[model samples]
Target: MSAPKIKCPTCTRVIEYSDQYPHRPFCSERCKLIDLGEWASEKHKIEGNSIYDDLLSDDLEQPD
Candidate 1:
């Protein structure tokens, strides 16, 4: 059997999904870092409220 192929999430570069590619889903460190930057900068976000949202609201509502 051959290694499975996948596209890098950042650049959409087709790559082999195997140990040879350390950044399997990304193709290179650059692409991996780019994706990380997007998340760190809030460019990418999961669609839904975070659990901490309720906790933070509760904290704000309490008298200090």
Candidate 2:
């Protein structure tokens, strides 16, 4: 059977999904790091209302 393939999340490069590709979905360490940087800078986020927003807003409305 042929190895499964996937596109790297950062560079969109096609790569084999196997032990040979240690980074798996990332293609390489550089691509993985770039993705990490994006997350750290808040460039990537899930589309949804965050549960923390309600908790924090409730705290702010109450007197400490």
Candidate 3:
């Protein structure tokens, strides 16, 4: 089992799997940093929701 070379999510730099390299999937630290920045800044938005809860609301009111 071994990691494969893939483009950096931020800079699209090809990264190979090896011991000589520390940050895999990224060409250099800068690329990794950029990716981190994207994550921190929330440039990507994933869509999903919990399947357990289907109810919109459960509010009950009584006249006083």
Local distance difference test scores for all models: 0.91, 0.89, 0.69
Local accuracy of candidate 3 as per-residue lDDT tens digits, 1-64: 6767777666776766776567776777887888788878988656665344434333435457
lDDT of 1 at 23: 81
Query: Which candidate number has the best TM-score?
Result: 1
Give the best candidate by lDDT: 1
Candidate number with the higher TM-score (1 or 2):
1
Which of 2 and 3 is ahead in lDDT?
2
Q: State residue 31's C-alpha deviation in candidate 2, in Å.
A: 0.2
Model 3 TM-score is 0.57
Q: Each candidate's root-mean-square deviation in Å?
A: 3.5, 3.5, 6.0
Least well predicted 10-residue stretch by lDDT in candidate 2: 55-64
TM-score of each: 0.80, 0.78, 0.57
Clash total of candidate 3: 0
Over the full model, what C-alpha lDDT does candidate 3 score relative to the true structure?
0.69
